[model samples]
Target chain A: MFKTTIFTLAIMAPLVSACGASYAPPTQRLADAQSAERSAAELGANSVPNAQLSMKLAQEQIAQAQKAMKDGDNLRADSLLIRAKADAELAIAQAREKGAKIEGEKAVDDSAAQKATNVGQGATK
Target chain B: MNTLRNLGLLCAFTTAAGLVGCAANIPPQDLVTARSNYERASKGPAQELDPADVHAAREQLDVAEAAFAKDGDTQATRDQAYVAARKAEFAEVRARTLQANQTKDRVVAGMHADERKAVALTSAELAQTKGQLATQGVVLQAQAATLATEKQRREEAEKRAAQAAADLAKFATVKQETRGMVITLSGSVLFASAKWDLLPAAQMKLNEVAAALTKEDPTSKMVVEGHTDSQGAASYNQDLSQHRAQVVRDYLVTRGIASDRITAQGFGPTRSIADNASPEGRANNRRVEIVVTPAATP
Candidate 1:
C-alpha cells in the first residue's frame, strides 16, 4: 500500500504543478472579489445598461468561484475570483462612465438655461 | 515488482504532460482578445488621460501573453487573458469618464464667465441711464425755475398797471378809448386864451397826472394833443395849439415821464369835439388830451 501511495504521488505531482493548482484555500481572493462586487453595486452598476452585462458576468464568476471552493478546488477558485474581480472592476468603470456622461450633458443644459435666464432678465430690465 | 510499476506510471504521466503541451500549440481566443484590447487601449485617450491605468493594463496583457506562450489553450492562460482584457476595457472606460468630467468642467467655467460679463454690461447700462436721468433732472429744474420767474414778473406788471389806472381816475377825467386810455384836461384850465404856458393851478393838476403816468408800465407809450375853438385865425390857432401841446409834453417829461415815450401833437378848430355856437360846447372843444397806450398783455 505504501508503494501504491508513492506511485500515485509521483504521477500526480507534475500534473498538479503544471496546472499551477494549490491545496491552500482562496479565502483572501474570495474576499477581494466580493469587495469589488459590493463596490460595483454601490455605484449602481446594475442600473446602467452598459454596465449590467459586466455586473452579471461578475456575479456569475463569483458564484462559480464559490462552487470551486466548495468542491475543494482552491486553485481553480482563486483563478475564478481573479476573473470575477476583473468583471466587477469593469462594471465599476462602465457605471462611472455613464454617470460622468450624464453629468456632462446636464452641465451643458444648465449652462444654456443660465444664459437664457440672464438674457431674459436683461431684456425685461 | 513495485519499482517496475512506479516506473511505468511515471512514464505514462510524462506522456500525458507531453500531450497537453502538444494541444497548446495555438493561442486561445481569450489571449487574442486580450492582445487586441491592449493594443486598442494604448492607441486611445486612455494612454494620455490615465497613463497609470494604461500601464497596468499593458502589464496585465504581458502576463497573459506570457501564460499563452507557456501553455496555449490552458485554463490558466485563458483566465489571465480574460482578466487582461477586462483591465484594458477598464482603462478605456476610465479615460472616457475623465473626458466627460473635463467637458463638464470646461462648460461650467465658460458659463460662469459669460454670466459675469452679462452682469458687468448690465451694471454699466444702469449707471449710464442713471447719469442721463440726473442730467435731465437738472435741466427740468432749471426750466421750472425760469417759468416761475416769468409768471411772477407778469403778475407784478399787471398789479402795477391796475394801480396806475386807479390813480389817474382819481383826479382826471379818465376814459377808455379804442386807441387807449385818454385823460382830458380843459384848455381853459391848462392855458390862458391863446396862451401856450400852463397856469399855476393847471401845473398842480398836471403834477398829479404825471405821477400816475410814471407809475404805469415802463413800456407804455404816451401822446399829448392840444385843441382850440374857432374864434382865432386858422393859422394862428394852429400855431398856438402846437406851442401848447409842446409845453404840456415838456412839463410831463420834467415830472419824470420818459421823454422818448411821449410825443406832442396839435389840432386847431378843425378837430374840435363840440359846436362853436355854444360857449360851453366851445369850452369843451378847447382841451388838452393825454393818450396812453398800455403795454401788450402777456
Candidate 2:
C-alpha cells in the first residue's frame, strides 16, 4: 500500500505542475482593464449617475482581479479583468451618452433663446 | 496496483459523463444571458448607427458561444460569455451615444438655419425702414427750405420799408395828427406869386413826395390842401389856391401816386397859421398840406 501510494503521488505531481503551468499570469489583461478603468475615470464617469454605478462595479472587479492574481488564480483573475473592462467600457459609454444629451439640450435651448430675441426685436419695431 | 488503476479509470469515466451531460443540458447562465443580450442589441439602434460596433459584439459573442460549445460549463466559458454580454451592451450604449450626437448635430444645424433666416429677414426689414426714413427726411428738408426762403423774403421787405421811410424824411416836414400823418410844403417853394403851376424845383421835390406817399399803406386816403395868405382877395385867392392844389394833385398822380386815393382842396385865407399880419406868418400860412389817413381811421 505504501509503494502504491508513493506511485500515485508521483503520477499526480506532474499533472498538478502541468495544470499550474498551463495558465499564464494575466498581466496584459490586467493592464488592459486598468487602462480602461483609467479612461473611464478620465471621462468623469464617476460624476454621472448611470456611469458611476458601472465605474464602481469596474473598480471592485479590478480589485478582485488583483487579489485573484496574487492568489495565483490566473484564470479567475483573467475572468475578473474581462468583467472589469466591460464595466469600464460601459461607464465610458454612459458618460459619452450623457455628454451628447447635454449638448443636444443646450443647442435646443440656445436656439429657442435666439428665436425669442428675434421675435422681441420685431415686436418693438 | 489494481485499486489505483480502478480509481483512474473511474475518474476518466466520470469526466466523460460530465462532458456528455453538459452538452445535453441547458447552457450556463452567463452564456444564456449573453445570447439574450446580443439578440436585444442586434434589434436596437446599434444595428444601424454603430454597425461596426455591433459586428464586433457579434464576433465576441461567437467566440463565447464557441467556448461554451467546446468547454461545456468551464470558468472560461462563463468569463467569455460575460465579456460578450458586456460587449453587446457596449455596442448598444455606443449606438445610443451616436444617436445622441446625431440629435445634437441636427439641433445645431436647425439653430443655425433659423439664425440665418432671421438675419436675412432683419436685413430686409432694416432696408425697408431705411428707405422710409430717407423719404421722410427728404420731405422735412424741403419744408425747411421753403420756410427759410419765406423768412428771408419777409426780412428783405421790412428792410425796404425802413429805407423808404428814411428817404422821405430828407426833404419833407412830416408830423402826426389825429386824422393822419401831415406833410407840409411852402407855397412859394411850390408856386410863383399868383401862378397855379409848380416850379421846376417844386416838381423835383414833389417827385420825392409822391414816391414816399406811394410807399404808404395802399389802403390809406390822401388829401392835398392849398392855403393862401390873407393879403389877397378871398375869391381870387380861393380860385388860385384851387388851381394850384389841382396842379399838385395832377403832378403827384403822374408821378405814380394813385389818383383814386388822392384829392385836392383849396382853403384860401379862410384858415391861417400865424397872425397873418407879419410876413413870416403870411409865408407860413401860404402852404400846401398833404394829409394821409390810415386805413383804420374812418
Candidate 3:
C-alpha cells in the first residue's frame, strides 16, 4: 500500500512542476514592457507642441504600420514603419534645438514641459 | 495460545458485525437529516460557512456506515447491543452539533436585528445629510453658474490678448526675449509621398513664415512639425517624419531662418485631420504642421 501511494505521488509531482513553470516569461515581459512604455509615453506627451506633434505623428505611423502587418501587408508595413522612424528622429532633433530635452526624467522640450507642469497645476486649454 | 488467538478473532468479528448492524439502522436516516440540515444551513445566514465541512462529514460517515452494513448482524443479539452503543455515540454527536448550531443561529439572529436597526438609523441620518447637501448644492450651483459666466468673460479677454499678440507676430521683423516659437504646422503643406522633401509651393509658404519669424528682433525662434498618415511601422514613420521635418528645417535655413532658433520635427501620422481610409483623408493626413506659441523669456 505504501509503495503504491509513493508511486502515485511521484507521478503527480512532475505534472505539478510542469504546470507551475508555464507562467514565468509572459508575466516578466508584461511588467517590463508596461514600465518602459509608460515613461516613454509621458516624455513624448508633454514635449513642445511641435516636437509633441512630431512624436505623435511618428507614433501614428508606427500604429499604421502595425495595422498593415496585421492586415497581411508586410512590405508596405515595413516601409511605413521605416518612414515613421525617420520622422521621429528628425522630430527629436528639432525639438532638442528648440530647447526640448530628449532623454532624462520627464525629458521633453521646454514648451511641452511647461504645458505638462501647467496641466498638473490644473491649467487646461 | 489458540484460545487466545480465537478470542481476539471473535472480538474482531463481533465488533465488525456490530458495526454492520448499526449502519444498517442509522445511516440512511442520518443522511437525510444531515443533508436537510446542510441544505437549510446553506439557505440560512450561515451560508458563508465552508461547504467542505459538511461535504467531508457526510462523505466519511456515509462510506463508513456503508462499509459496516456490508459486514452484517442480527437485531436481537449481544452484537446488536454493541451496535446500539456505536449508533448512540454518533447520534449524540449529531445532537450536540445541532444544539451548537441552534445557539449560533440565535446569536446571529440577534446581531442581525440590531444591525438592521442600526442601518435604518444610519440611513435616516444619511437622508437628512443628503437633504442638507442638496440645498447646499443648489446654492453652490448658482454660484458656479455665475463663476462660469465670469470665467467666460476672462477667457474672452485672454483671447483678445492672444490675438493681439498674434497680430503683432505678423508685423514683427524681429522679436527678442523669446526663446523660440513652438509652431505646429499643418500636414497639408509639406509632403507628396513617403518622402519628406518640400514641394515648391510649400517652400514658398515656408519662406513666408520664416520671413515673418526673421523679425527685426533678430532673436526669434522657429520650430516646424512634420506629420504623416498612419500607414507604416512606428520606427519607420518616426524616422521618415523626422527626415521630412528636417527637410523643411533645411529649407527654412536656406531661406535665412536662423539656424540656432529654427528646429524641425517629424510626427508620423500621429495627428490626423481626416481618417486614413479615403484619398482625400490620406492627403489631409499627410503634411507638415506648425504650432506657434510664445517662447520662454530666455
Candidate 4:
C-alpha cells in the first residue's frame, strides 16, 4: 500500500510539473481584447452611458490582464483578456446600435424638413 | 489491500475533478435572458429606428443559440449568451436614442425652413415696396414737370402785360375801347389847315406812336379816322378829311407799319366829339383818331 501511494504521488508530481511547464503568455487574447476595445471606441461607445461603462470595464480588465501577464500569471491573464474582449465586443454592439438609431432618426427628420420646405416654396410661388 | 484502496479513492477524486472541469453545460439563465432581450428589441423601436443595430443583435443571438445547441453547458455558450444579451440591450438603447434624435432633428429642420421662408418673404416684400416707390417717384417727376410748365406760362403772361403797360405810358395816349386801344392826335398837329401834308415836328410824334404800337403787338390792325368841324360844306369837308386821313395812313405805312393793317376813313361834320359852335370844341373835334386792334394771340 505504501509503494502504491508513493508511485501515485510520483506520477502526479510529473503531471503537475508538465502542466506548470505549459505556461504561455496570453499574447493572442490581449491582442483580441485591444482590437475589440478599439472597435468599440470607433463605434462611439464612449458617447453612450451604458456602453461607456462597459468600455471602461473592458479597459480595466485589459489593464489587469497586462499586469497579470507581467507577473507571469499566464492563466489569470488569459482569463482576464477573454473577459475584457467580451466586454469590449458588447460595448461595440451597444455603440453601433445607438449610432444606427441616431442615423435613422436623422433621416426621418431630414425628410420631413425637406417636405415642409417644398410645400412652403410652392405656396410662395 | 490498503494501498489498493488508497489508489481507488485517489482515482475517484481525480475523475470527479476532471468531470467538474469539463462540465460544459449550457448557461440556461443567460440564454433565456438573451433570447428575451432579443425578442423585445425586435418588436420595439429597434426594429425600425435602428435596423442595423437590431440586425447585429439578431445575429449575435443566433450565434448564441447555435453555440448553446452545439456545446450545451460550455464556456463558449455562456460567453455567446452574454454577448447576445449585451447586444440586445444595446439595440434597445440605440433605438431609443435614435428616435429622440430624429425628433430633435426634425424640429430643428422645421425651424430652419421657417426662418428661410420668412427671409424670402421679407425680400419679396422689400422688392415690392421698392417698385411702388419707384412708380411714385416717376409720378412725382411728371407732376413736377407739369408745375414747371405752368409756372413758365404764368411768368411769360405777366412779363407781356408789364411791357404793354410801359409802352402805353411812354408813347401814346392810349384808351381802352370796345374796338381796342384808341390813340387821338389833333388834326392841326398832323397836317396844315385843310392840306394833306404833315408837319416836320408831327413826323417825330407819329414815329413814336408807330414804334409803341408795333412794340405792343406787331400784328395789330390800325384804323385812321379824320374828323372835321361843321363849319364847311359837307362834300368839301368830306373830301378834305379823306385826303388828310389817306396822308396819315400813307405816312404810317412808310414808317414800317404794314399797309394791309391800316384802314383810312373820313368823317366830315359827323360823329363830332364836341359842339362846333365853340372854337375850342371845334379844335378838339377836328382830330385824327387811330384805333389799334390787338393781335389774335397775345
Q: Score the docking of each candidate (DockQ).
A: 0.52, 0.56, 0.00, 0.11
Off by over 4 Å in 2: A1-16, A19-21, A123-125, B1-25, B72-74, B112-148, B175-298
User: What tens-digit string does per-residue lDDT give for candidate 2 at A1-125?
Assistant: 99999999999999999897778989998899899889999988989998999899899999999998888888888889889999899999988888888888888888788778878877323
Clashing pairs for model 4 are A1-B3, A101-B98, B24-B73, B24-B74, B25-B73, B26-B72, B26-B73
- Of the two candidates 1 and 2, the one with more favorable DockQ, higher being better, is 2
| TM-scores of the candidates in the order shown | 0.68, 0.70, 0.26, 0.49
For A13-87, candidate 4 gives per-residue lDDT tens digits of: 989987876679989889999999999999889998878999998999899989988988877778677768868
Deviation in Å, model 2, residue A97 alpha carbon: 1.1
Interface RMSD of each: 2.1, 2.3, 35.1, 6.7
Instruction: For candidate 3, write residues B151-212 as lDDT tens digits.
Output: 99979777765654465445222233234444444455555666666777676666666655
For residue B132, what is the lDDT in candidate 1? 100
Give per-residue CA lDDT, model 1, range B1-298, as digits (tens).
Answer: 9999999999999999898777777788888899899999999999999999999988998888888787667899999999999999999999999999999999999988887888888889999999999999999999999999999998987787677667656656888899998898889888888788889988988987887888777899999998889997998888888889999999999999989999999887788789999999899889989999986687
Q: Is the docking of candidate 4 incorrect, acceptable, medium or high quality?
A: incorrect
Winning candidate number (DockQ): 2
The C-alpha stretches of model 4 lying farther than 4 A from their native spots are A1-29, A35-49, A67-83, A89-125, B1-28, B49-52, B69-72, B96-108, B171-298
Give, for candidate 1 chain A, the lowest lDDT window spanning 10 residues.
A116-125
Runs in model 3 deviating more than 4 A are A1-125, B1-189, B216-218
TM-score of chain B of each: 0.69, 0.58, 0.36, 0.49
Model 3 per-residue lDDT at B116: 63
